[model samples]
Target: MIVDSLDIQKEIPLWALGDGEKVIQREFVFENFKQAFEFMTLSAEYAEEIDHHPDWSNSWNKVSVSLSTHSVGALTKLDIQLAKAMDAFASQVNSKN
Candidate 1:
């Protein structure tokens, strides 16, 4: 099931509540293009492993991600889980730099 917008906003402040065509969205900025691309690559692997993917774009040092469950026609737990994973990955990458 898709989580309530209020709950998602409260859970992930870094992500906008109603972005991504009324789904959840966030932009991650890294130290450089290499770091940003690496984050995307890593996130992609994880997304593939979980069978959940994010609609995302990368430019220079920023990655814009929009997460929604197309199967459900709304944001579901899978979206939240992937968002959290992306957040964690970003944190880890930041620490490495």
Candidate 2:
């Protein structure tokens, strides 16, 4: 089921573009390309383990991510869970800087 924007905002302060949309978005910036790639590696592993992949792109030290459940045609619990996990991964990478 699609989640409410209010609940998602409360859960993830950094998430945006969730106003009746199928996706929730966030951008993570790292200290350098190496650090950014490391974040992607970690996030990719977790995403594969969970079987939920993000629609994302990387530009230099920045990673832009959008989470959505295409099968459901909306953002579901999986997107929220993955978003939280990605945020945690980004936090770890940021702290190592």
Best by TM-score: 2
TM-score, each model?
0.92, 0.94
Q: Which ten-residue region of model 2 has the weakest summed lDDT?
A: 14-23
User: Which parts of model 1 have CA positions greater than 4 angstroms off?
Assistant: 19-21
TM-score of 2: 0.94
Candidate 1 minimal-lDDT segment of 10 residues = 13-22
Q: Which pairs of residues collide in model 1?
A: none
| Cα error of candidate 2 at position 49, Å | 0.9
Q: Which stretches of candidate 2 lie over 4 Å from their true place?
A: none
Q: Give one digit per residue, the lDDT tens place, for model 1 in 1-97.
A: 8688887877787988665445888999999998998899889999999999999898899999998988778888888899999999999888887
> What lDDT does candidate 1 reach at residue 36?
94
Alpha-carbon RMSD, each predicted model: 1.6, 1.2
Collision count of model 1? 0
